[model samples]
Target: MCVYVVDDDPRICRLLARLVGLEGFEVHTFEKAAMFLENLTRLKFGHVILDIDMPEHNGLDVLDHILHQKPYWPVIIISGSTAMDDAITAFRRGAIHFLRKPFRRDDLRAVLSEARKVGVKRIAAYELQARVMQVKLTGRETQVLDAMAGGLQSKMIAWKLGLSIRTVDMHRSNILAKLSARNSSQAVAIARGLGLTQ
Candidate 1:
């Protein structure tokens, strides 16, 4: 995976590039938050190491933009500020980890390891969501599938949906065929796996 470092300090950026590179990740450095945001669409799957203090745009603003555009991307904050509020705000804004400036190599490594695992899960979830989107289901079929996932029988689902039992059964059969599942249980399982049902 790639590691994108956003810090205004050239020395710090170079140090982070070298350090992260040694860990076998491709490294990209940006001196400004605007540059990072502008190039976001071109970036590969990766985590970000961002410094809180920078000219033009601060880390928190950039963090907000990142989360807005790509909610699953992991962002690690590196700041010299010791203010507890900054750390709290960072976490509240969905930062994966916050490291104080002059942070130890071991601490960065640990967070990067954690971020890698998180990144993998996020990617898998995105892929599953994409696959789920490709499977077209009618509104009523979706309702039936959701009711099935909730462990509702055909009679119960029909009553809840204000539909006849035969209509509910037809929807169930269509859902099973569309999902390529043999039974209601298997259909529910597949729907959950594809993120179509909770």
Candidate 2:
């Protein structure tokens, strides 16, 4: 599996790169978020080992960036702060593991192994939850979401429901905004996780 090692600490970065490389996996290391972002799409990476703190862009920012584009890339954050709020924030951003610094190698490997097993391309949990909490739909939105879950388009949903395409589009927008989800996929992920959609 392809793994990205992003850290500001040179020694730590090198050590991780060496270790990950030795596992017969492809490893890419970056000292800054800008560097990582620059070449982010060069390959399809499986997991990211990110530091929670950096001079400019922290792990959260990078996490958002990844989700914005590469929505399926699971992250394992390495935090030296160990602040509860920080860990919570990182978890909210969909990180699989928030490991404190000075952690063992096996700890990181475990996180990576889990991420590789649970690859999400169709949905994310947080966006689904936000969608559920925000929408005030009385079965209509639920119906729309069910069709969406089946990969139906607005016109298709409208055709099936005997409603105009414009109405379906409006419902779609409301679903996106109400759930605070940035996109349809995110909304679906969150909605499904919340059990708002069957």
Candidate 3:
């Protein structure tokens, strides 16, 4: 599994990269929270080692954004702060682990090992859900369902897709049937749960 180390301290980043690399995992280091957040969408799925104390966009903010967009990715908080409140906040925000600075290498390795196992399971679940959607919905039906999830009515979807309103409605009906949903709203909810629609 890939591991991303985000810290403003160059020394800490280098130490983490070296340690994680020795464990046979790919490592990427970012010196700024903004830089990491800007490239978040383009980066592949991986575990994150984040520092809570940063100039702007602290680790908690980044953690929230990651959970909001990619809840499956594991985040490990590494901070020099001794405040118990920081640890509490990190756990509350869904961090997988918390490590203090000057921590043992063995501790870091253990956390990464655990994160990798959980990451594999979550990724497999996502892929399975995606395959189920692919098997159940036609290409056009998926498009229509995505549009519905985006709060577009059949008329708007029809105009955007250059299809008749009747055709769009038909696709919506098919989506509902294939997903075993009672209504368009239910279909959208199912699609979202399956991670089929953004």
* Winning candidate number (lDDT): 1
Candidate 1 error regions (>4 Å): 139-188, 195-198
Deviation of model 2 at 70, angstroms:
0.4
lDDT of 3 by residue, 152-172 (tens): 998999999999999999999
State the lDDT of candidate 1 residue by residue for 90-138, as single tens digits: 9999999999999888888899999999999999988888778778889
Q: lDDT for each of the candidates? A: 0.91, 0.79, 0.90
Give the CA lDDT, 0 to 100, for residue 196 in model 2.
74
What stretches of model 2 exceed 4 Å from their correct place? 120-198
TM-score per candidate: 0.77, 0.59, 0.67
Q: TM-score of predicted model 2?
A: 0.59
RMSD of each predicted structure: 3.8, 9.9, 9.8
Ranking by TM-score: 1, 3, 2
Worst lDDT 10-window in candidate 2: 119-128
lDDT of 1 at 33: 88
